[model samples]
Target: MEVPAERVEPKVEAAYRALGERVSLPGFRKGRVPRALLEQRFRGQVREDVIRALIPESYLEALRETHLEPLGDPRVEEVSFAEGEPLRYRAVVDVKPPLAVKDYSGVPVSRKEVTVTDEEVEALLQQLRERAAEYVPMEGWPALKEDLVILDYQGT
Candidate 1:
């Protein structure tokens, strides 16, 4: 999808100004640097910020213009910026494919019946009792198959 020139320009300028506010120069205090000096000193950083800002706005515009519902994030194809010019980029996106439901209302579904039994409840109670059981040190002859070994585990 193509992004309109008019809409993107103002956003680019705003991004540039915002970037200028955060950038520092040799003589200028924080957020007091001139726009021209900020451009000269931090062209790459400013362009990156402007492109980051422009892409989301441009993508939204592209979606509205084309009337497309995107399925996932768009893949950025290309981005370009030059001094005193608006940032530009191309993006490729996957849109939701057209679909039709056939006999959806008549589709048969089955659910298994479940009932809690006294035996199952007793088994669960037994497990909880085991979890609450205290561990006591026993005279060892190495660990056995059923022994629960409590050890302090440490790792780097």
Candidate 2:
């Protein structure tokens, strides 16, 4: 993405004018700082600001000109800028690729058979019994705090 000198010079000048307006200098009223002075005092800053402002704009402009639609943020590098010269740069952009329409009419999908054994069924029944159990009134009997069950020992 290279912005020609003709385009960049005006923007740099505009940036200088904008900075001059906001900055205060001794013996100079606000917005009255000269362009040369601004360039001299804030040279690196002005260059940085101008380049920062130009890079994205140029990148977008190039994209539009090339008719390329990008999918993500660009990786910008190899920036080259000089006073009174064109702003040159290289941006690695991730372009949106055209996708093909997929046909699924003939696709085969398989399902695995899962078997439930007797133990599984019993476990499910036990879970249901525990979940559904509720306290009920005993008929013709007094309520007790606890109950015990007696059973014979057996092997599985």
The stretch of ten residues in a row with the least summed lDDT in candidate 1 is 1-10
Candidate 1 global TM-score: 0.54
Task: Give the Cα error of residue 119 in candidate 2, in Å.
Answer: 25
Tens digits of per-residue lDDT, candidate 1, 1-156, equal 444566566765787688777777788888898877766777777667767777887789778987889999999976766645555677888898878877777778899999999999999999999899987788655888877887788999
What TM-score would every model get versus the actual structure?
Answer: 0.54, 0.61
Q: What lDDT score belongs to each candidate, Candidate 1 first?
A: 0.76, 0.85
Number of residue pairs clashing in candidate 2, backbone atoms closer than 3 angstroms, sequence gap of 3 or more or interchain: 0
- Give every collision pair in model 2: none
C-alpha RMSD for every candidate: 7.3, 10.9
**Model 1, runs deviating above 4 Å:** 83-87, 101-156
Q: How many backbone clashes does candidate 1 have?
A: 0
Number of the top lDDT candidate: 2
- Model 2 lDDT tens row, 41-128: 9988988998888888888888888989888889988988999989998899788888798998899999999999999999999899
